[model samples]
Target chain A: MTQPIRVLLAKVGLDGHDRGVKVVARTLRDAGMDVIYSGLHRTPEEVVTAAIQEDVDVLGVSLLSGVQLTVFPKIFQLLASKGADDMIVVAGGVMPDEDVVEIKRMGVREVLLQDTPPDEIVQTLTRLVAERGER
Target chain B: MSRYVPSSELVERAARGEVPAIGRLISRAEAGMPEARGALATIYRRAGRAHVIGLTGVPGSGKSTLVAALTARLRTQGLKVGIVAVDPSSPYSGGAILGDRIRMSDLVNDPGVYIRSMATRGAMGGLARATLDAVDILDLGGFDTIIIETVGVGQDEVEIAKASHTTVVVSAPGLGDEIQAIKAGMLEIADIHVVSKCDRSDANRTLVDIKQMLTLGAATSAKPEWQTPVVGVSSYTGEGFDALTRAIDRHRDVAFGTASGSRRQLAIARFRLEKTAENLLIERFAKAAVTRAPALAERLRRRDADPYSLANELLAASFERGSAHERDHHRPPHFAEDHW
Candidate 1:
């Protein structure tokens, strides 16, 4: 049975550096996730709205700038209001570990610090998809 | 023997293993059908079973060979892969030649792989919603990983992530100002960066430039989960496919989680809806104006009224209908076609 994981990846802030995000987007696309990239300078609200509307299984936010707190929460609160408490939110960028923890508590499940391998990202998603695929 | 059929019928028949019908439906979409929306919706409910990966880079990035290599490796793992290879739309005929898929002939006929070639129909970026829709259908049809390979990420390749989960930006050894020419929109969307055709002389320099760019792009306080991993891969000699696939698996499996999944879906859904509405409204608005064109134009030519006023008069109700915002939000097909 073929199921394409729907993923919403967005750049949630003013930073427009997406070289990394573009690579990850293609990687996920090849792996078979229907990925939607919310274009540059997307507000947290726009990113979250796109995630909810796309019905994505993975919401991967790419931030080159250090504003995950403001951006991630806007997305989180937006998802919460839409009754999507179980969605997966992943953040990737030059994030420090402490900031990553704070985002996680606010509803993000995993925070990928820089240099994480692509296979690891795929593996995490595969396991989660399999787990959810069971549900 | 394949021919256009009602989208619903073709979609239903295609669902039952009728490959031809599926081809026809995809062909119609390739031909640019407004009704592909319904077919896409049917496909969406049954989607989410495939891993969607996107490949993009400038010309000669060897995206095709890279994809071929990756597909070969994925096949080794006993996985069924669907490849959506996009070629640039013919400027004259407004159709795609799909020359990229020609490189993956080894697996094209394999029952384990399904390869579909699409022409980039001015979707502004090699990635288009229709391409994504096709991916959605294939996903529902049960492919393990759906690969959308763009020949190169030219100015138009910006559209990739609108429909995929992971976006991979590919670069190779030989560009002069690729670093400088990179735009703000294109600079910020990568999840993984690959140096395709790395056997070239200056591949290392390109890699270094990519790293510098990634670093320059990052900002304060945003310690993202992972740094953009730049890997060197040569699609021609079967080098790095394993590591590439490994990178892909990690990005998907470890870097993603459950909190934002639902929200991402919403973003795509809304974008699709808005796009559909915008298209329909434009089509309808254009049609309405065309029907009344003769009378309005005659009046204007006679100096009886200004063209803008006439246009406003003719489109007054449509304007009052507030269809602009709604049109920006959603749409259904109208009776008239833009038939010449």
Candidate 2:
């Protein structure tokens, strides 16, 4: 049987704005991916632990609180420390282009901005998993 | 990352309490990957030491929050806890949003607690098919208590009772009096009933209603070895958790310590055997249908054959091919004979 691509969407730090994240969650779910939402105000440690435990193919951190630069690095550090650096990490929500480039440099596989269309979001995630190939 | 690691090595790492190894094995098992079968059998043999608890209830009943609270309570006693929380998959997309971990954020960083969220993946009865397998993997990983928090369900999803040594059914206030009365199917299967959100005044009514129903059930039936207790708790205030844990512990004692406990075990084994066989047979049937059903469907559409006979033919062909395939592959040692 073909396993569904599992993605964990986490709202890290003090971000209470989850409307966009919930929309992305629905988009991912409707596009045939198992989405585990870690809810809001999750610590970087909590997110990485959840990502590893869920054995997700992707970890999508939605941050509208503008802590992407600070949080994504810490998340990647935790993931590396836990020997789960192989997991594909993605970032979403409001961020400037320079921070996006820096976040990508920090080892995030993709940085999805707030305005990325639903279909594009779905296609991008699906292609990322496909490019990574099967487990 | 796609490189194959032998299952033996994975199992060895899992036995040493490696979280990543256990998680990987569980993922393999959940996906129904054939390579994990021997490893799973080994894990199964090494399991049964952990106390398996099932917590299930209706939607909006606070099952997930209660699980977080209960896991916290269990952890205070220095017990290692493993949690399998299940959520439903959409019928259209075959995907799910497993939001149980949202309520369980505090437990995430604790090394003593391991939580895995599962999608129902088209399985019925409010549980994923691999839930018990995950439980076994966690059991072999040295968890002292394994808790399965099922997808929020209504009356008919009593499969948790068959899979667990202790089943706790959570009920919340304001769902209506008639709704509780109509849930006799669920009420009968509870080893312990919890009225969550007890900070609300209406929780007292729910508690009383459940207690009254249990008393009525006890009077009509032969006295059970364990009397089901209805305890009110509030995740917000943390009221009555100690009493709740005590009741759960008491129920576990009766389930494992008494002669009737052995009977319960036999029943659980029988249920598992039947359910596993049914799943295997369905899987085989689906596999066979992929290759053979189109022609059969054409014949049926043309009125050349009926469904029953064609279905029987399909089953026969599938099993015949299965046995031949089994003959070609080296068979693993039977569970009873394997000493490892």
Candidate 3:
């Protein structure tokens, strides 16, 4: 039986605005992955646990509260400690170009800036997640 | 490691009001087993005690903030509250997206309030089946009111409203257009309509739009005689929590009624048993289907047999299992009846 690719979309830290996140959620749902959104204000641990239980292939976090430095590192470390390093972690939100580049070095697959179109993020993620399945 | 499964043990402890043990017990019970079933039965009796209030709105409608305020007001009234915050399940990651901590900051330190965020788990209509189960767990844990905060808009809100005594639909000003779009649609599910972020100038227009929709809908749709009350409040400024709480309180008692709430208890009991039975049957069906379908499908695909004959064989097999279940399940009762 063929299962739809599963993506865990989360909003982390003090940023509680979920308009962009929900729109992305609708977009992803239309794109045909079994999208599970953690909704708003998720911490790294909860996101990791949900990924494990939901058996997701990619963990995507969209943060707009300017707390990327605190959240991204924590998610990466938690995933590693939980032996979830194999699961791809993607970050998006209001990060500077330099911060996005720096996050990529720290084990995040992509840094999605707010300037990035919703479809662009979806397409990038769809390609990355689809590749993970091929392996 | 002995595969140290404490779930069974934890479930037993939780039923007895050992507060610390409830979470682990709920996890194990959700996993489902004989022990979990027994634990659920004992704990489920305490369920119908709470009034179920459903809070739902659009994305960015500030639902979480509103609920946090509702929790505060309920606490002041010396009421124990159970909140089941429904989160969307992601397609790629297949997990809960909204984190538990940040959404419900106020309740983190409060022992009186228990907040559990649930992913729809790929289920349509927003709230998951497990959400009902978790509500019972908290009800048994002893809450006076249980609030279900839904993840998104549309049909899911209506479904949850059917389950709750009072369904509070939250929305804001700028969302006036979208709220109007769904007015004759899903927003009609509300027992009370709340317009949050009332401080904004547009809030009044949004409230007026909702009222007009309500008025138009009331003519055609014979809703309960009481108009679905509309209130404007800003969760940020701590406004209107009191009225929302009062309305929630009054609506619950009247809807649940004079049997001293025996009917709601029966409803929840029915909900629990129905769910438990469905869960068991589904598990059995899946296991059997997984093991046997490939060969059946392969033969069908090869055109060695027609679909009609294939279905007949499958039906016969299912009938055999049905008879076996009836025989085993009814034998003890049959013998007792015969003896009588």
Q: What is the per-residue lDDT of model 1 for residues B1-340, given as tens digits with 9 covering 90 to 100? A: 2123578876776566444455445655544455666776677777776777877878777887788888889888888787787766545434233346446645533556666656555556565436767776676656778898875666555656655666788877777676557534455667678888777878888888888877787784132555667888887676677778888887666334533444545665676677656655665566556556678889999999997899887775344343442244233444232331
Q: DockQ score of candidate 1? A: 0.01
On residues A1-135, what C-alpha lDDT tens digit does candidate 3 reach at each position? 233455778877778888877777677666655566776666677766656444465788888877877887888787667545677788877777777877898888877776778788778887886666531
Q: Pick the candidate with the highest lDDT.
A: 2
DockQ of each: 0.01, 0.67, 0.08
Cα deviation of B178, candidate 2, in Å: 3.5
Candidate 3 Cα errors over 4 Å, as ranges: A1-135, B1-12, B15-17, B219-225, B258-277, B299-340
TM-score of each: 0.60, 0.93, 0.63
Candidate 3 at residue B330, lDDT? 21
Candidate 3's residue-wise lDDT over B193-242, tens digit each? 89999888888998898887777777776444456788888988877778
Candidate 1 residue-wise lDDT, A10-121, digit = tens: 7766898989987876676566554555557666665554454334567888877999888877777767675555677888878778888899898777776669898888
**Tens-digit lDDT track for model 2 on B1-340?**
2455677788988888888788888898888776788899889888888889999999889999999999999999999999999999999999899989889888987999999999999999978999999999999999999999999897789899999999999888998865565358788888888999999988888888888888777876542688888899999999989999999888788889988777888888898899887787677567668778898989999989899999888877566634443343223234221221
Instruction: Give stretches of model 2 more than 4 Å off.
Output: B1-4, B220-223, B322-340
